[model samples]
Target: MKKVKPKDIKGHIEYLADDRLLGRMPGTEGYKMAADYVIDKFKSMGIEPAGENGSYLQDVTIRKAVTGNDATFISRDSLGNKSELIHGKDFVIFPNAVEKQTTLEAPLVFAGFGISAPEIGYDDYAGIDATGKVVVVMRGAPDSFTSTVAASSMDIGNILQTAANHGAVGVVMAFTNPTAGVPNISRGVNSVLGPDGGIAVSRYYVSDDVKLFSFISGETLTNFLAKAGLDFNTSLTSLKNATPVSAPLNTTIRASYSSSHEDINSYNVIGKITGSDPLLKNEFVIHSAHLDHVGIGAPVNGDSIYNGAHDNASGVASLLEIARIYSRIDAKPKRTVLIAMVTGEEMGLLGSSYFAKYPTVPKQNIVANINTDMPTIIAPLLSVVALGAEHSTLDKPVANAASYLGLDVEEDPEPEQNRFVRSDQYSFVSQGIPALHIKYGNKTPDGKNNLNEQVQVWREKYYHKPQDSIDGTFDFDAGKTYVQLNFLIGYQVAQNPERPSWNPGDFFETAR
Candidate 1:
């Protein structure tokens, strides 16, 4: 088989990342154009379509819901006093936590960091009857978890979910960072349908005026408990001892106004090159990259189009290049090689989630998924930060492939960043499929300082903002080597001897 050429890969990337694509946001005309280009690339490259039957498009079902004016929110206190909280004025609210506009009049308990970690033998909601009342927890993790992070070992998000699971009617979490602020709520796209309609993600906040009650911070709640002379560690106990000092805690808030989401049709672009052996053909090697970006935003430097040239335009380029290489290889995989350019990734892995719900191929046969989202900008590639690196028996296959490219396979530098749980790969991982994700190290090309400083500079100034446009100074040279590493992964998985698996003691492994 001939080696993939860097020149050919760049040609496809140049066209896809061109200003014409308009950032390739899903459900938009520009997204349609990008989708069409992807299918066309497959046709031109002579890659066999492996979507459905013989089609190139694996159509995914999606439901969009916009908060209608009919959806109203209000609150009443113990004195039977009530106030109408205006919508979209005070803060943003999501119907996500619970279906109906939850009305909580029972005692409001301030639960300290509402975290529960069985592994650590701790439960924040322990011995608390918080069924109908709202528990005000603090933003971020508890002290125990923060200490673990400083020692390079921390995973508290899972513990945070305990509040919802433990029957807390509603949760009000406050921020501790006075300098930095919490992320504003963003609009959600419902990919999975529910008994009511669809399960929508959280909502973007509106300004003050719509809130049913006052919002309290963790610091303030903690202070209130401390002033009451109760043990702070015993959160519920403290709340129980401290008698109510106020008649009603009411705060006004509002939710952002957007068109109620309508069902938007979309598809996952898939192409495949089948293997030779019959038994091996049943197996698969999956290569994926998301094709969605933040659509239109307010405006940046007079340009509203966020031509996400670097965000994932770089990723799609890598995907297409791999497809072209696999298509032209003299010898194909022992199993099938799947090249997928998934959609709705910006919308909570919606496309991949939909694919999991309706797979074109058997989910059991998929060996592993390699999803590339953010690429290594001009920075050097030192190691492969495989997100679920420890879960699978496929680590050797990755190392074998990496060795072929003279690259090292390493665990993610920022697992705390939760890249494993952040991208399209998580959609498949949730279903027990082993996944590998590679990204760049946090260092500048010139090695002047850690890339985190610059990234912080960019995130504050550009991240997800209209300012995230590509500039001349960005280092893109890493793309070539990055693709080299991926090409090896694509080939090796296609020809690997054993299937990847979730390692022993992995939570997802037991789920499967």
Candidate 2:
């Protein structure tokens, strides 16, 4: 194995995260520069181009929506009293609807957690008839759940689809963990939905036609629950215990929204190393990373650029190093290797979804995907967290890689984040591809910072902020090690004759 140098890794990060790249926003000139750099690197290494049209770039068209100011909502109680709810304060509209302007006047019914799982004998919408009405649900699944059920329930897209299947005209989400009554709406419409072949893409085609969607404030939700003779806290506890209590608040809601959209274009940089074995070359082991980050945002600490140095610039840098290492190897692996630096991942996993739905290579030919999103290397790595590791046959390989590095591989520490559904790996998983999303553990092996306070501090201080750029706090050695782990796992997958497969009877296996 060729040694990867810290300086080489740092150099790549410095260039990609530089302010001159303007945060590498999708479809921007800065992002184009980054794409050009990736393609040039692929060419210089003599890696074969595998993108559409005999090029190293797959075009992903994007649509940007700007919500108009005319959006409004009004609430009416059973006693015939009307109150207007202010937009941006009481609620925020979901922007995925295709219609530019829509209005819905319907009754709102509280649907415990909006989950319908017959396999688990739990259906939140069981006795509730939500047809031609509005359905309100809590943001997350019940706290008490089996690991499998919890994973499925955390997929919000699936939750909304279930609500639509019940014939609900609109869906309202009440965040269990409210952020000061202001829903954390992305400043940009990053949802991978709708038509016109834009930046947003998905593995399964979901209906985005549920036009009336909103997230109400905690206070608003409490008020509604009060009128329905349900204590908010008591009801939440009951739901967590699986004794769901769903009822109508004897209230009606009226909402109107409008938005304007524009077409934008981005690219996914792709290249491959052809295998020597004729038969194995037909199958590919993919190494992927997202290149886009949240572009310029509100000024923070007197700086405007949200340079995603650690958020993902580090990840792309790792892919480049992996590519370099594979290109220099004398004896090529039996199976082909694909390198994809996708775009609009920060937007909504758009680039990867597009690739998954319209793969340049036959989708069946893809064996496995290894993804690196954001790697935090505050201290020397002692542990590795492999998201979705146990769901497939990759656990042994990843554990073996960690063992080779004298590190212990563990499951995700913060499952509440629902990380499995958050990254680019989800795009592949939704399509039945066995994948792993790797990250450096929060604690050291010796138990120093074992609680992962360092990472918590980073999230609070630099995550998605201008301060994420390289600084004294950054550790180059840890970053190099993280990249090595990815190399080890991918190399093993490419060398093995049998393609990685999903665990028998796993939820994802059903996708196949």
Candidate 3:
């Protein structure tokens, strides 16, 4: 097998992160340039096109919804007193992706975390009858739940669907931190549109029935809860302790909003390497990385382009190197390998979700996905955290690969970040396919292993900013190691006869 070279990884990043790409934001000519670059590289490597119509491009239509100025939110108490809240100050409304205009007037029901997972013996909607009402929920799960499960529980899409399933007309997500401000939706919300021009997947706007989805400031929530004779802190404490505090609020909210949408075209670049075994070749192992980033933003330090060198340029580069390694090998793995550089990941994993839902190949034939995003290869590659791997038999391959590479495998040191469900891997996991994302762990050459601390400093400086250009901090050797580690893990799965399976009685297995 040919070894991955650090210089090659650097070369790929140098081009992808160049200022000419303009951060590779989807729907822009710069993004098309990046897609063309990937296609050209894949073609040169002899990788077969595995995208739509035998080409390397999968069409994705992204709909961006912006809330109109006519949006209004008014809270009326049972005593007939009304208080109209200011938009963008007290709260911010999420644009209705499906409907151009939406209006709703309903009573509010506080449903602790808005999670309905009975397998874990925790259901926030247990006793609450949220019929024809708006559910007010905090953003968190019970402390006892596993990291991945907790992240899934707090997912906005799941929360909205759960609310809709219970006959709720709307949802209001209250901030957990009293000092936290309402989310800034100035750039509008994004959703994937199906071939029929309907919503295929979205983090917001669950369905037509769920008309209103908004976020309230933590201070405003405290006042709202107070009107119902409930202390916000006490209710939050009870919910966090898994005690399930829910009730009908004394206040009813009336909200009206108009949404305007702009549709943009994007693409997911895909390449394939056929397997050697005839039967095993039917199944595939996916290697995915996002090729998009937050475009030009408010200038910082006199720079505007948000070149995502470490955010994902490095990740895409790693996948390129992995593809090259396969090209240099004489004998291929038993199962096919699909290298997917998806777009619209920065826009809420839109590209990956679309591909996962409507893959070029049969969805069931896909056994596992190994995703790479923001490896943060600034320090020596000493340890790794295989996010989402523990939920399935993919953990074995991760262990074997780590052992082969002499890298330690450790638990996520920053579980509070909710990283498992934050990236493209979650898109596959949501579709019932086993998947995992490789992330840097807290390990360093010096025994202190305080790499996480260093990463925090780096993140503050360059993460998602113009400073994230190719000139940013980088350890190319670490990038080379990451490529090898991820390639080995996927190679083992491709060689194995039995398809990778979810762990016995795992949450994902039973849930699916």
Candidate with best lDDT: 3
| Winner on TM-score (2 vs 3) | 3
lDDT of 1 by residue, 258-327 (tens): 2344566677888888887779898877888887786877786787877666667778888887777777
Where model 1 places Cα greater than 4 Å from the true spot, the runs are: 66-91, 96-139, 142-172, 176-183, 186-259, 408-416, 442-462, 465-477, 507-512
Where model 2 places Cα greater than 4 Å from the true spot, the runs are 77-79, 146-152, 177-180, 184-186, 191-208, 442-451, 510-512
| Model 1 lDDT, residue 113, Cα | 52
The lDDT for every candidate, in the order shown, is 0.59, 0.80, 0.93
lDDT of 2 by residue, 421-504 (tens): 778888788777888898766566566645466677778898888898866256778777887888889888888888888878
Best by TM-score: 3
TM-score of each: 0.76, 0.91, 0.98
Comparing 1 and 2 on TM-score, the stronger one:
2
Ranking by TM-score: 3, 2, 1
Please give the lDDT score at residue 189 for candidate 3: 91
* Candidates 1 and 3, the one with greater lDDT: 3
**What TM-score does prediction 3 earn?**
0.98
